[model samples]
Target chain A: MTQDSRTNSIVINGLNDSAFKVRLNRNLEIIQSVLANPTTVIGLVIVILMLMMALLAPVITEPNMPDPYQMPRDWQAARSAPLTPGHVLGTTNRGGDVYYGVVWGARTSLKLSLIVVCLTVVLGVTIGSIAGIVGGKVDEVLMRIVDVFLSIPELIFALAIAAILGPSFTNIILALVVVFWVKYARIMRAQVIRIKQRDYVDAARIMGDSKIQIYLKDILPNSFSPVMVQATLDMGNIVLVGATLSFIGLSEAGIAEWGVLVSEGQAGISAGRWWASTFPGLMVFLWALAFNLVGDGLRDVLDPRTETKR
Target chain B: MSSADKTILSVKNVKKHFPIKEGVFQKVVGQVHAVDGVNFDIKEGETVGLVGESGCGKTTIGRCVAGLEALTEGNIYFDLPSDKIALLEDSEKQDDKKVSAEQIEEIGNSYDIGKIEGDLFNHYRRNCQMVFQDSFASLSPRQLVSDIVSRPLRVHNVCPENEVIPRTINLLEQVGLGAQHLYRFPHQFSGGQRQRISIARALALDPKLIVLDEPTSALDVSVQAQILNLLHDLQKKRGLAYLFITHNLSVIRHMADKIVVMYLGKVVEAGNTEDIFANPQHPYTKALLAASPDLQSEVTSGMAALDGAIPDPARPPQGCSFRTRCPVAQPECGWEVDDVVRRLEHKDSIFNFLKEVDQSDAFNAKFTFETEAAANQLMAAMKSDDIPDAMKKMVSKLNCDAEHVTVSFKPAKTVPLIACGNGSSARCVLVNK
Candidate 1:
């Protein structure tokens, strides 16, 4: 009987080729939907440009050797104005180059957001998976802990933690890491809880797949889109929060950070040396706006309600 | 198409009760008796159709058979040898010659899906698979057709690494889908095509028993026939036993060799399909057959759709569970004080003034009313035509004292499934007589 059925089937040649084509088409469809929105395209372009600027920071401007992140001070160019010869966009009161600050500020912002987002996403997913899967007392206890973390306002919580750890760039990163992870934990827990009940997970269990296999293959992958969207949004949020913390004098003075440069430039605002503050501040606004637009577009595209359409 | 008398799965008085919890401390207030002492057997390569209305515990029984749920009571023996099955049945009968305890223990350790461990449990897992109702939800949205169908083989290492793809394509082909259908997500397929994929996945491991939990319920009628035909062809080729669960009697009549009718977590009737369809002994089964629209039947007004919803499974009525809605209910059909309360609770005027009920047992209870007039109203209601004649006849004692009305019923025992001579059983007083 099996032989008869096999003979009846029209076996196509180049099985792998067809399989590859199907996968490619599915991926292309996802990409097309994600790029359909105009706002998302604008966000994508700005994000790419910002990323390029960050990557080429050292190549675009000579590094301040020994400590590249430390702004180079030139007493001769002190308080220079916009488009001044050899000092475009002028310099701060202490002669920190505005052009250098703007370029390097992207690198700083990217580092802070990427590191915090990565660490927090991993931490949050781990805790949330444990809570959702283990449930019972562990779920109850972990959710209470998450609720405590969520109760406090995000910015103030990051500020207090950074303050307690003392003023430094590393400490601000640590504070943001601590503050941002709880939301991921909350989102992942909810997602895991929802996905674990899906019939495929039950089917996997019925097939005698190991618990870890079910979690990694069935639950995690299905539950990950929302987390992906959250991570993208947090790429913007983490920087905004970190910059705010830095602007409040939590970070060391004169670092090549956007928030520190904005603070330094604010002091000279009354004296008409606006280029110092304006350039780096504009970079911060663009960074946050680009990611926000992209995140909103992603939320619309990857929304679970519409996920089946693809 | 069934093989010689070999039992593939035997569900012996299985019960699954889920706890209803409340409050921060998660207190167990009560239990919903989802599957209460249900028993049936599926022979090798036979289809046992479990037919019931929605929430009749058909799906729960299916889940238990697939080993997806832990049974709160009783055992499900999977792939038990014929000799061991006979011994187990004899032991259950408790005849003069009893099977030894050690032999029973041996059979349980080897055959019971719940008690078996390690290699034996894995063997059971490989042999039993499930195809769920919602095709869209059952197949993983993230998985391609190749991954979904090939998953069981990979999990069980049923074949070598290199042969997984060929074997997957073969499985897909057997389900009427070719290799071109592989590598696509579940969302890309039509409902019937998705169901075909699900069947292909279930067929991957070449399971001995497949639990079809309303597998074609979500498909269009035309698509449903195609899937059912595909299932029949696959079964014929593979010699697979199926626990076919569905509420559609017409579908069951087409697919099942034997049928088990259930009502409120208990089997109301069980027999060969032709016998049950020709002469349904249980009232619920009769009502179901009457309600189903048969094309050959000339009288449309003959439809006897059951009135009243199924009673709460948490507090299932005594005796026959179907007695609440049985048109042919008798005096001995176990009418109790709860029945009186259920009938009169809808009358707001009488119940609003009713304060409490002090009950000694299900058969007896004393009603305390806010006024003597309210107690008289309750007494009048019980004797009125609003109450069934059988229920009124079963009331052994009824009296209205100033502000209290006392009612007592002849205590009825829980009805057991009685054999009716020709390889059939029914849970009804009329059948027993």
Candidate 2:
């Protein structure tokens, strides 16, 4: 409150500012180390390409054109092989442009995986934290339910649910979500059990934080890095599963999905018109691979063990 | 001291027994008596140091006071009304479990914190906070410095929405940290600075009592001094009652006005800091002071070390818990059969000869050794200088046959705390005698 005290405080702040700068520099160094890894760089490039494709999907396609899911058939240009103008990479037996299917499929694929991952994380984390923190009859009941769901093989469960719900985009998402949320829940429960014992959580309780507040604010945030890594890795797996389901005819038939695209061209593959299915199949593989690489990269950066190992 | 100095927290006969369960059924087998019948109080604007060895339950008592752990029995009254205290006393007398929820709610006029429900509990929680031993673990790594300090303010709704950051900055400055350190996470700061942040957070609620659980144990010596000074300055600035828990006597000597020395979950001695240090009637207190080397003490004064570890809290010695290692233990110190085993524990040759024991109680036991000579060896040692004369006098029965020896001490009363001087007490038979 006095001028002398104000000046004294300023001097103290000045002394600490240099130390603060050193810490900032160290943080930047860690970021620099992460970026320096070649795997992370390659992963970054592929991730950027896919992200751009997904983000620019609508602009790249003709919005007013009916049936934007697939290109219109061109009978005159049918069976055109790789590098053919206007229908680059080739034309399918159905005469739809392979490039169009690949481009728009990115949007559908990204959106589906993101929605599924988000739903699984929210549902799983909420349930898992509650089970772990409460730790009694409630924990026993919830965890046993998780165990039952976990015991059922993921694909089998997804197939049964999708079949019962019948084929639709929403139904497919619902099935995938039901199958995937268990993974997040189990991971989150384990994380919550560990973090809840941490001193900071105890401090929060002593600070008068309600049980809900402690879980949401204190325990959940500390457990985020692991959940984020798991989410990233699962995004790729979910997309692959979505594609597999569609290929097996568990998905809506008329969709811009990569798995559907491949199924449509499967008949042409035996007739020596390999471009029909090969290009679409290749797109699916590349999409999964790109996400996997990015996920791996993120893991290396986010995991404290990995950072310490370096 | 005037009547204005009110008691901020009063803990009476607090006990916390953690259930130790085993087997497939997970049935409760035993309980670790973590804080067994401890009592102390913190007056407003004063510091009371809870000094003890690691397993002595100082931290547990702190947690109980901070409302982090429920008391298994007894009461922790926080500025409770006289009528409410009377009601609690009635409930305590009548069968504590049968005390209805309505009674608890009615007694919520003032807090019997462990029993009070809803808003009363939250009020006690907000008014009493804890600063833990480990600063690194106590501050969440994911949170920035500003957010960590501002958390209490935001949780308690101490200020308006827009002023949270500014208030946090002000709190930080009071602890000698400032705007430059705001956005950085806990790991970025030095140990001292992080502890400062913890102090700042504790101060945020304008609490009446702060349970400082070894706030300096994890810090370097110089940093500890700085933090202690900061704490002192803050205490002076705002009339805050502190229950400062630590194992370091010198630190307690410097910071605390009243000192409570605990051993095996029980307070052995407690009094005003100056009086207790000047004349520690409890032998345990004397051993502790002598064990901790002080520069002020003569260099030729050899440190007096206690003989063994703290007894198991699950079954603490049935007498003065310190008697087995007490240098001045006497006949009336409640010598028991457990003491003979404890005495033989350090002498390898004597302990290795004996195998089995048939005991009726802690005070008597029949030992079956390998041969008669080994049994006679213990008897001879008991009379020799190896054992104390006072213990030898308490040996009312000692019989040795071909291979077994039965021994028993004259049953003595369990030592209780006796008043020694003005406001000073000790759990020693000598003081009582």
Candidate 3:
């Protein structure tokens, strides 16, 4: 009886720890696994640096005034080479400051990718989850729509939508959102379908848990990892695609965007004024490559097949 | 430890058919009769073992009981009063019973698992819980042990928020776990430990009945015994009724008070555990018993191993579903045209030459072959030793004219389960005698 009482006290002490600690521990474990790989760490570093650059663009470079996103003109340093005093990283033939453009380009790309990713993820996950959970005729109709979206090549499809909507950064974002959400919808739908069949979901249902509760607790958490992996991969791909759209003159001229800077710099390339285009072009490549690396690492860590080992 | 009078659950002629869809439109072409017309009862504190091979619909029956799958037909009355259960049983036994149809309907509407809604359904859910076969699949990987075990308590508001933790701890302790295991995920535990966690979760709501769907099948032999013993002790302490479903006869023999032996989608034999073991009336039950290894029996003759594969559930045989595989199959055990086709379809020499089959019904068919010789060969094959004597004996007509060979079997009725004394029943023609 005394032994039982002693154990009971221990139980009480253990139970005092909040559920938050459990969640924290689980999340910490996943983070640890994701950070274990060297390439992921490198990608993470590049992503962090890029994010910092974007966040601190105003502090690093003086705002262009009226509209900070529009590149500041420097007529005196037009076509100037890199490292020239007051004209660092040179200037475009049209007098756009390349330094200001590179720094602010990060901010533009970040804003564009973040908005598109959030919108597409929300839209895709919602539609996919509804299709998966409801199933039958509703599933059929929704999936057919997803199929139509998925049938065309993503770039070509986005190009068509952007072209139709008229050339602008916002239109490009809208086009990216349309082209991107379908893959996520397909992924999330498949994941939900698979995870819903799991015994835990059925167990939850058997416990008289409402359909919404079952979806939230059993189905959603288990199925969200793959969506996350896809989201991370798309984070980089979106920027690359956005830049490509802007490169072809889809975006507003003289804006502080990497693709537009590259487009402006391309005119002076044969005259050896490559700094203007090369720097912004390099930023795009690094941004895409970094996310791709991180996404692959996340896949390796979060893939359900490998999850059992942990 | 079972109190013989009060019934906890009454499964009455339950059937569950899953549609097999085809084409892009998903048109329903056929149905897989997973559980067809199963009947049984679990009294308070009793353990009724549902034993069958895989695909015999034992799991489907368990799912039906757990309210996982909506029933295609019939009602599973939960926690009906003893008198009502007796009245229902009486009505089943005798068509001209005194109990009115409206009274049965009232009882079903209130107590049926499928039909009840609102507070009544919640009450049933609280009373009934299930421990799945795969512990890994049953417990949420993302949920902590405390959360997994305490979820039911919290959902039902069985206790205050603060009290949930202590109650969950108590439950864990009951299942042989400790407070240290509270914050750990499911993957942190061994197979046996995970199963213990599952049991703790099942016991959280103090359920009156727990459906054990092959709970120990995924564990090691030693672990299986430990889990079974824990379950037994828990049942004895809580007076919980259990519907233990498994294919392992040894496990069932050790745990079950009453045994229901199923073949295909129907129960072939059901009785008190000892009675079914000592005197298995159905050939399927006898074959099952002989197949299962027994320590007490020194000699392993292995004579009763059944031959032939289970027939397709979509097109289940006309009469006895097990007659196709039963060693002691009789002439009266339904023989149909499908059986002949099934037997000869693999024989390339005869089946490859067959052009078309004009099946008028299950028992009668005309085979139009590519050549007259093939038709004559089929006729010869029917009379040959390759066909079972019972099936050959049941054939009433066999004629070959040119490329057309007509074969007909004696029409047979669907076999019904007959009472074979001592609170037991068997679904075989021999049982009627």
Candidate 4:
């Protein structure tokens, strides 16, 4: 369909018995387009599978009754190859079931990444909007603080913060949030500065809307699309970074995090038991790839500049 | 025009001056006198047209009345009952200066919108709304038509939550849109449609007064007429008072009951629309009428184009602001050294020969030219017929020597608006004297 007709249909179908239904239809359309792209579909399948594993972690590991967080000591089954009936994807040198580790690893990876991304976005958007909208001296002070944080490289800053706080689940999440929030703050602040000057904002003021009401209802919603796309893409990177910290032992030693699994399996790789490390490593690659593809698909659908091309 | 007519809005000497900031510390350097001592009244069901060239502060005055801009000085009293208005007028008659802010505030039925606070401010906000010029930019792109039109109702709590949508639909229908347009964003519509949507949004609150700021400037001529007619019908139906701000004389001539002609932030002429159009008292008003194509007849030979641009607001010339460009400018039209310099600045050859200027004030200046001939030429130009006869008559002193000329003019006071017969007033020195 031509762009004009699509716009017309959007208008015609926009308001009805419920606004919720209109939003749902828009989301469905975006999903349909994402599915139409073959590469994105592959990514979607991987993402869905990962989500299922994360959600059904206990069920996946319950049949064998292996504790995902414990090291296996059954020497007989320790180095068993892939396709073992009791232990699929083989076993580690310490006899931990790789299948169990991978299944429960999805939960740790997804949870930490989600928590970090959500925290960063919330912190960044609030601070950024306040800074841009308030302007003057307050803006100058906040932006200088942002500059101070931004001047340090992300991995280095996160590492320094993590090292200072000591290895723990919450500390790692904190470090990631501190390092990632600056990116969102910069982008959201720029968007706020541009959007606030638009005449609609003035019109909203004339409509007797308070500043907070205008920000939440008129300004922020319009400025959030790019931030959302950025957040989606950042999710993949956040997981990777979390895993890197875990591999370096910033997290608990025997946790079922994918990076810890990779670190533990590195010892047996030269002994020709590559399946132990390779499977978990493949899972990490697939997780990041899924998020990246989804982010790309979202950009295509949400960004008006690219909508014309589609 | 009658004493029985009710006044919905009375703007008394409204002034809005915006400061110009310079350097990093944002030190105030000067102020732009956007609306300088403007006064007008809109009856409960009357349309008042504010006409001027761009930057004459017509929009600024509208914004002031709509409570969008805080006044620098002056008060906009809203919804004054006739008895209280008479009381206010009696206070004015006693001694306008002694009419205290408390006295002004004590008027039971009137609310001074510019100074009102809290609940009263919100009350005035709900009662007076504005329709902006740029419809596309004025409507939030992310919002649906239903939300945009219903926003005022929602903001003021004008309707129950469930009734908001239906009320919005009714407003859209009034503006010529239908249920099909409710869910659409502003980008989905053309310019004309977008303006209609804006109008619907403004009309949502059932305001007693609506300030329309160049509502039809961005639309096509045909579309302009349609919007004007819609406004006329809506006004008649609702008994709405409109502060219509526009530079388009023909549009105002058709819609306005009272026409106010502003020049450089001051109202130069104001009267009934037909009387002002038929017998314009102010030179600026006459120039504006001549420039309007629809008001001109083929038998009139040629349209009189307004010469020169609007004076800089920060440094507006000392007298009748219109006098600098008024064809009928007189000796008493506040001619100063600034006028001499203004004329010289535009004449390149004479200006290039100028060397130094020593001034005591706006009325006196001594010029040293490049050579004696330049000084002689300057003296001659002051007496030439090209100079307005009024200006020549006011030249109190003109002395020329080898390379210098000193010219002084009789100091003239700025002209104040004076009442002519037939409910018209003009700020012209000729008419005032």
Candidate 5:
């Protein structure tokens, strides 16, 4: 019923007849080995908790709903101190609750990162796969474009695009994908280049697959690992990138973004209200740290070379 | 149904030459003749062995036959009647632009290689497949065995989606795997097991011709034996035609119905496997057999150790191509100034000491000798009895008139595979055609 026992049974079963169960054990070992690393474990837990908070923020918190078009403050409970008990994290200078702002901020930042990472992975995998698999002139042309994309500073470019696109959540995500996807494509393209040259790809060709089918069926599956690792790491990066964009006042009008919360908290910092920025800022660090930890764990687990230790 | 009418694939004078550049600016340079003028045929329900050294172009010819590579010259006619291809050729002579319509139509209509359109290409593709060398690298790491094997069936719409798993199970069973393998990934399988999975995937289409390119070279010997036996049994059951390409002579002996001996880019010898092994005609084929390890027989009898590695296909020996190493090279095996220079480069250090080379032809190169003695040494080496008596016999003219010595050697013709005095064909001068 549980994944742990399932893994145990596979390991045990694998020792006897030593057939397909052996293969299952191999994949299980990779998953376990990745999850076993302390940093990865910690990162995964952090990411999981952040995602849960984002999803269940409505159920766990009772924030007084303010009009979306208007500022989020009662204007009466403004600039209240911490440990107000029912107001737990206290109130913002705008009379909006600081704890509630953080809960909403976690949801926003997490959503933006998740959306941006997915888009980047998809786009990166697509372009990278094409460049790597279909070698020669097409590859030459695509790799040069990737080089140009990679040459530009991702955060600054993301800010510029977000500013021009006028800062809806969609626009920020689009900007993140536009700026960050080149890395995935570059990683994926290299993986694909290596994979496409592999004997399995040759076997696929000998099996009489068209060039397109070979890319989709043969090259695509193998290409997913590096991209998956990149995607998980990019989730952390998108959060940092997104927060920076919001921090610079380029966020959508009235959105409760983490960087926006940090700026609002900044205005109140002089008056001794620190909760405004600290919680939102801490959320960003925790999520980003979690992604890097998970990324390192995934590299060892997914890489074929590391199997010897396992 | 007749033996004469049953050839499944006919490779007629296939040639594939890859360009090689030496200096700068990437000028039009020498061509590394990968598959040069190779010819063979696989009859229905027969496995043909194509054996040679590493750069002998056996795999290149196989790739050409499988339609994986476009031939620079000549054509691979799969499942076409030799008589029909000959007739199409005669027609091609009359009309220069005649090849596209009638020739392709003849191949398509006769053997049904299928049309060039969507379903047609799929049909032809389904009929032919390949098994690669490296088991660890061939199967996709991300895919489960089920997905890898069942992919062809799904792509061709050979079976309904639900039936795909069942069909895949059937294929797996045929290859010694079972239901438990359905969800397992390739990494879970052993080297032998992964190769089985690759074979099962190849067999998914029920193909007529499976291009087995070193199917067992990467596996352990025992595993290779098992795979070879498996292939033999499967061939019997499916009545499949096989292009069994390998560098191992013993494998070809066991598995190949007919054997083709290739050297550089040419078929040096070809005929029934029985005739080839019993009486190898080409000198290269003889050297290859002598060098190959034979398990059933002990070594050091009449067996040969090849004098040296194969010459670069880019700059093959001009006359017999094997003249450089041919123990039985003749006065007309095409020895040239290069051969004399080649001899001096090895035996005379003075020729080796030349800082630069100026060439007049392959047989005549002007060497800038540092001293008169070295130039005379280069001239003296050309006329030496120390060189193989046969190669020395190939010298037509020798001139050491320059500090840059020039030697004009005999120009021998390329030895094409022709029918010998016996029923078999050989590409050697030893046997009269």
Candidate 6:
């Protein structure tokens, strides 16, 4: 880099440092609160390990793909059972390694959740903020529209959308995003509506702020708390929705998704071949459970009401 | 442009009435007369204090002037100059008087506040800022003091973005907040400090007319004194005008050069603060001084208070609004049949039983009674001296035909605030009597 470029970077760094220190301090305060609770720490560790497992999927597993219809040629090699070297948790009817499937399933689940969450939070907050700030007949109409979506069962809506969109992991995420955004929009809209009436908004108005300026500067930033808490909690629900869609056969056409593995295990179970479904089912349960625990623990920490409670 | 000669803002007979919505369909029932015909002029480089009880619409008047609320009637004349003030005064002649939007922008750049456009509104906004009552809720907690104070400067392009923090720190210092406080959030500061930051933000625009709307009503007395003194010093240095609104008599006495005492929604008494304080002419003004706990007489005598509660603003008492609560209510104080019933109804069951009252402007009522004895009792009460004598005397006829007592009160015109005893305005019949 040029010397001038380095100087410009330094100037920008100083600006960022000064601008966001308070936000950083508040984030650190949340991190410290999580550290204060041991169960929360354990949940955090589980999440960290899950993240690692998802990231290291290719490195740990065989590069080759498993043949879904391949027979277990060597019975003992297939029935080597859990705790045996290389054959941990035994093998499926297709002779696929259970450990490899677990690693790969973790990757698919995490990636799917991250995509759904990004879509839900971004689209949801924007829609909610507009509905909230432009309050009047528009607010009433938008809220009723949100109310209709929120009233529908999450499972039914996901299923109906997935059915129409056809079975694929991408389609499942799209369906879940559609179903999940309503909650963020509702929480955020309510929060914005409440905060927009506060005296700060009035002060902003008296300061000659236009409606757009008030919405961006006064309403949205102050209304961030409820949306933040909802977002954290909504992660668990989003993951669950993804897994449920996969279980109902809306996963990538033939790839081994956790839910599809569970379905495949159920098909293999009567014949006493339970490894395929059981391992993937445990991965899905553990991921969802970890997210929920972390979300609940973060909620107890990030929530302003809880601070007041203490 | 001369300091001592300019009339900064002229408020004409301003009236603001809020509509009352009632019933299943939510029909526009009637207007709640929040502010009815108020007029006051705020001079350049002077503090004009607006004092009244909580519901007297002092804040409403401030809001109307500040353009927070729309005026239901009347005009607000801003002395923003022909450049700023001249164009807004044009309610007609748009095309002929038309300057291009760009030329209007140039006008904004060249003229005083009353003469400008977009930039002038920005200038007017910066010049005529307001400080709110509740310091606790006024500042946004999530924001840093630097950001909050620098917000106005940024919005109006008062300074370059890089110069913002330095300017903000300077403003913070000006308002008693310092360098150590700039990076802190609103919750990190105490109430007084937060209010100082709010003042700093208001001052960031370098406004000439700061509307301190009960700025000290929500602070500790000592803190209030500090803010008051800061405001005093700032005004002295900047030569600013302030429209100080408060219910606190003592604070208004110390701060205002001219005081406007409001009752119901009208200015009942207005003059130099010394004149109003030394010899409060209006009976309502006397009652306010009597009621102010801080200014109790040293005689240890029971301070004379108005007898009843404030008359309902929805249907404010006719003739004189203060008559219902006046220590000296006269008979011709527009003592209507309703007032006679209101006065007697509370004392006995004679009023408690009557289902409905059908009143007419003809000073008569159709007889509708649950029982005849109740009607007779009402007629008897109207004749008694326990009620106003003028009510008993001016009441031309009382004919109790049956269960309905058709009584007629002498029709009296609504008394205007007329010049009365020793340079005072009295809105009562007896003042002329």
Task: Give the higher-TM-score candidate: 2 or 3.
Answer: 3
Candidate 6 local Cα displacement, residue A13, angstroms: 10
Model 6, span B1-433: residue lDDT tens: 1268566876766888988877644478888788888877778899988988888889888877666777888666666454455554452256556645675555435542333458656756777888888876788867778778888887788877656666777898898778777778787776787789888988888887888889998888999899899999888888889999999999998888888888888777777777777766667777788888777662133448767666667766566667667666677676666676667757767776576667886356655677888778777777676687656766777787677777777777666666655554545555556
Evaluate residue B121 in candidate 1 and report its C-alpha lDDT on the 0 to 100 scale: 96
Off by over 4 Å in 4: A1-23, A26-46, A61-103, A190-213, A247-249, A261-286, A304-310, B1-4, B86-101, B108-110, B157-169, B179-190, B298-304, B323-413
lDDT of 1 by residue, A25-106 (tens): 8778877988999999999899999999999999998998888888989889899998899788899999999998888889
> In model 6, where do residues sit more than 4 Å from their true spots?
A1-23, A63-87, A91-98, A164-166, A250-254, A267-278, A304-310, B1-5, B20-30, B80-117, B298-303, B306-319, B335-433
Q: For model 5 chain B, where is the 10-residue window of minimal lDDT?
A: B295-304
**Model 6 per-residue lDDT tens digits across residues A129-227:** 888877666777777888899889999999999999998778888899999888888878878877877778887877888889887887877777766
Interface quality of candidate 3 as DockQ = 0.61
Relative to the true structure, candidate 4 reaches a TM of 0.81
Clashes of 4: 0
Model 4 chain A, poorest ten-residue lDDT window? Answer: A63-72
**Model 3 ranges with Cα > 4 A deviation:** A1-22, B93-100, B295-302
RMSD from true fold, candidate 6: 6.1
Q: Which structure is stronger by lDDT: 1 or 2?
A: 1
User: Is candidate 1 or 6 superior in lDDT?
Assistant: 1
lDDT agreement of model 1 with the native: 0.90
TM-score of decoy 2: 0.81
- In model 2, which regions exceed 4 Å deviation? A1-34, A58-67, A70-80, A92-96, A151-171, A263-273, A304-310, B1-5, B23-26, B80-111, B117-126, B159-169, B295-303, B324-414
Top-TM-score candidate index: 3
Candidate 5's TM-score on the B chain: 0.90
Interface RMSD of 2: 5.3
Residue range B107-193, candidate 3, lDDT tens digits? 888999999999999999999999999988898888899889989998889987756788888999999998788888899999999
TM-score of each: 0.96, 0.81, 0.97, 0.81, 0.83, 0.83
Score residue B215 of candidate 5 by CA lDDT.
93
DockQ scores of the candidates: 0.54, 0.35, 0.61, 0.29, 0.29, 0.39
Which lDDT values do the candidates have, in the order given?
A: 0.90, 0.81, 0.90, 0.83, 0.76, 0.74
